[model samples]
Target: MKKIHNYFAIVFLFFALHAVGQTKDNKWTFGMDIAWVSYSEADKIAVGGKFINQTPRFSLAKYMFKNVVFVGSVSTAIGDNQTYTTFDGAARYDFGTSQNKVVPYALIGGSFINARILTPTLNFGAGSTLWFSPKYGLNVQLLYKFSEERFSSQRSHIMPSIGLVYSFGARDMNPRIWSSTR
Candidate 1:
């Protein structure tokens, strides 16, 4: 497991650096997701906690490849103490290219979980982004989180979120509404 973690980390770093090299200009997105974290079976990384936590997740993403984007997010509770807070970093590989109005992707990432105590989490999931225009749209995601510590307060869980996404940069050569009439 240690070796696997190391390999995954190395691969993640390689792709992240490579993407920066390959990128030319404008491909950045900012998003806010309303996340509902469903605590799975007992010991779902929170020790006897099996419930759902609703949170607002803020994220920043950069498109590195034609099909890959790296996202970093921070989430916390609003008006609740039992909710979990997390800082996450993930890479998403979209099935559709940049031109599509809707793009679905697979995700893998790690998280620093703060429930009762701090723990590390490995997460995998799928999501999609729906673009209304080149600038704005909706984003949704579902993730399965696995806690690293077995004897701690950290437990496993499923998280799903929906939110708005805004894109900025030079994705289109000419940033204008696609209309025929002048």
Candidate 2:
């Protein structure tokens, strides 16, 4: 677990530094998600029962390039007797022009899940956003996650979520970073 955390920290730092060096017109987005999560193998042992669950998630994203965004997310699932948490970092690629009101995207990422045992996870998914206005939007996503623990040979999770996103900074156009030459 310690090693996994360290790896994520290093990766996050690298992306942050890279983002800072690249574009001055980058935008930031903060979002809240509601998801239905179903787990395999591990959930039985961890929760001591079989149950379907719901999770509330939060995420932050930075648009580092025209179509590339770096994202960090956290979610927690609570049941009668147990709780599970996940932390994830991912890169997303938007499929169409940003000017469009609706845009689809795909993402791949690494995740850390804290359950009965700490498990490192991998996820891949696709999602779309419907921007009602320049600063606010609705997002929907579906993700498949894979993980393994000593006690549980192989564990998988399916997560489908819907959320609202709030954007900060200029919309669609690059903001001027310096005055034009006279």
Candidate 3:
């Protein structure tokens, strides 16, 4: 498990750095998400019950390669007796277009997740996120988390999320760094 985590870390970092070099600037995406999260652990103290989850996310992207963009996102939520926060940096490939009025994208990235339990005796968590965004329409996702607790075992979680997105300066593959100059 450690090895797999390390490998994923390396790959995600590589892509994230590559994305930084490829983007131009002045593009941003903002969204909000509602989800359901379930927690079940053999050690009762490690996880709690299922709960409604809602996250508001914002991402900034810059064009680099033809269809590629570098992205940074942050999210926060309260759920299942805990409060969660996440930060991510990734590379994305845009498939559809602004002209078509529907934008589709795929992203692979690395994230830091922190969870704090409200109950004093329960455990909190800190972990990484390796996720893929198959559909960017309406800013919804099948959210996935690969997480580990300080005293508990590692786990993979999948949840359905629905959100709204507002994207700005999404014109070309490599949008001008300063539209004013253009």
Clashes of each: 7, 0, 2
TM-score of 2: 0.71
Ranking by TM-score: 1, 2, 3
Estimate the lDDT of model 2: 0.68
Lowest summed-lDDT stretch of 10 residues in model 2? 173-182
- Candidate 1 residues lying further than 4 Å off, grouped into runs, are 1-25, 44-48, 149-151, 170-182
* Tens digits of per-residue lDDT for model 3, 26-133: 244444445555545543345443443544355555666566667666656643345655566766665423223334556666656565532111122221111122
Residue pairs whose backbone atoms clash in candidate 3: 22-64, 23-63
Q: Flag clash pairs in model 2.
A: none
TM-score for all predictions? Answer: 0.74, 0.71, 0.52
Q: Model 3 compared with the native: what TM-score? A: 0.52
Please give the CA lDDT of all the candidate structures: 0.69, 0.68, 0.45
**Backbone-clash count (model 1):** 7
Candidate 1 lDDT (Cα, 0 to 1): 0.69
